[model samples]
Target: MTALGLLYPGHSAEDDYPRIEQLLGSDIRVDVVHTDIGEDAHRVDALKEMGSPERLAAGVEQLRLTGAESVVWACTSGSFVYGWEGAHDQVRALARTAGMPASSTSFAFVHAAAELGVRRVAVGATYPDDVADLFASFLGAGGVEVVSVRGSGVITAAEVGEWTEEDVLTLARQADTPTAEALLLPDTALHTAALIPTLEKELSKPVLTANQVTVWEALRLTDRRVNAPALGALFTREPIVQV
Candidate 1:
């Protein structure tokens, strides 16, 4: 069985990984190790500390026991808050510590968008506008365009986790724009594993949520792909070929 390690920030939606593992069937295993979350605030300083090398290193030690072939920092705000370049450096450090292919949910969204050949996307962010703006900038650096962004201004991961399915759908609808090719829900704290197909159907477009993209990114690093349509458009079609 292939094993993917997820270094999640806190107690929010870490459970989504296991749900993904089940959806992918028994051939894959998703192990989650929660890292130190000093302050759950969505501010830049708190987020940077949340994704610090020291904390990631500690999480990697636990994942090593799981024999995870790849690792992903399963927090979007935590990584994107560091900006594009810094996020790259963060995963590089994680890879070194884990001795495995490593990435973060922020990069996951970027790569997932590229795989689907989606350039313009609308963001349904759970962060404050300032923090949400940083995520848009991070996506910009990856060559993805943000057609629009809707921030909930939620202060903590705990609050985002408390959001219900209807709340998620409402955000997707509000954030979607006619110009956007897809809608992105960029908070790992939010529970979305079961709402991907519903969200995509309701919006009539691709819906890329944090936990969904996080699993997809881990599969990409392992050079493996599983056809799980329930995961939504990201998993329903073949990867777009780049010339």
Candidate 2:
């Protein structure tokens, strides 16, 4: 069986991961490995503390034990707060420690955008404007253009994690525009994996959410892909032909 490891930071809306696992069914499994987080709030200094290189390295060994072929650092803020190059080093550390393919949620958004041929994109985030801006920068560094970004000013993932599907849909409409090829919701704090299809329908453009892209990137690293339309348009891409 194919398995992708998700190295989750504690401050995430974790329910989203299992939902993806269930939707993907038994042929593939998403194994979640966690790192320490001191508090659930989104203070920059505090978040930085949660994702130290040592903690990330610890999680990699755990995921390797669980038989995960590839791993994603599953928190957006947890990685992006480190800046673009910093996030790259974070994943390199994970791969170096685990001896497997590795990536982070911030990079996942970049990879997902490339999959859909999206360059200029709008962002909707659960973080305060300052925190959210860093993500837009991360995307820009990775060669995806950031058309615009609207932050919800949410102080905690605990709060965003509780948002109803209606709330996510509303954010999609508010964050998207005709100029952008797609909308990016950048927070694992928000439960968005199940809402991807509806968000795409409402905007008539692809929606890339944190956990959704994290899972997609993890699968891609494992040299596997799924064609589940129910999960969202991202899954409907033509499977990568192995060399």
Candidate 3:
């Protein structure tokens, strides 16, 4: 079995891993190690602290001991809070510490959008506007253009994690614009695995969610592929080769 390692922050999105593993079928297994985030007044600051090199490295050490083939920093805001270069450097640090290929949910969004040949995308995030803008900038640095971004202004991942399908569908509807070829919900705390097809059907375009892209990115790192129709267009399309 191919073991994909995940280093997540706090309690958010941990359950999504099992859902992803099930979608991947019986061939892949997801092994996860979580890191604690320090308390802070602002959500961005808390995410930054959770994704800080020191904390991430510690989690990487734990996942490395699990004999994982590839590691993913499975926090969207946590990874994107540093901007593009910082998010890149964060993955590099994890790879170095784990001695394996590493990626984060932030990069996953950029790459997943690229896979669908979506140059301009509308982004809906379950974060404060400032934090959402940082994520849009991170995608921009990766050469994907964010046509528009709508943030829910939700303070914490824990709060985002509690959002229902109705909440996500409403935000996604609000985020989609005329020029957008795709829609992005960039937050690992979001549970979008089961709702991807529904969102796409409603929006008449592809909807790339954080956990979906994260799993796809992990599969890409290991050169593995699966046909997950229920996951949406990104999973059904051709595998993306990172340039």
Q: Model 1, 1-243: lDDT tens per residue?
A: 889899998798888878888999899999999998989899999999999999889888899999999999998988998888899999999999999999999999999999999999999998999999999999999999999999998999999989998899889989999999999999999999999888988889999999999999998999999999999999988889999
Identify the runs in model 1 with alpha carbons over 4 angstroms from their true place.
none
Per-model CA lDDT versus the true structure: 0.92, 0.85, 0.85
TM-score of 3: 0.95
Maximum-TM-score candidate: 1
Residue-by-residue lDDT tens digits, candidate 2, 1-243: 998898887744888888998888788989898788667767788777777788888777778888988888888888888898888888898788889999988899988888878879999888889988888888999999999999998997778878988898888888888999999998887888878888888898888888899999999898787887877878887633434
Which segments of model 3 are wrong by more than 4 Å? 40-42, 239-243
Ranked by TM-score, the better of candidates 1 and 2 is 1
Please give the TM-score that candidate 1 achieves against the real structure: 0.99
lDDT pick, better of 1 and 3: 1
**Pairs clashing within candidate 2:** none
lDDT score for residue 173 of model 3: 98
| TM-scores for candidates 1 onward, in order | 0.99, 0.94, 0.95
| lDDT per residue as tens, model 3, 1-243 | 888998877776678789878988998988978887666223667778888889988777778877799999888888888888888889998888889999998898888888888889999987888888988888889998999999888877778778898998999999999899999998877878889989999999999998888888888899988898988998798755667
Ranking by TM-score: 1, 3, 2
Ranking by lDDT: 1, 3, 2
Clashes of 2: 0
Top-lDDT candidate index:
1
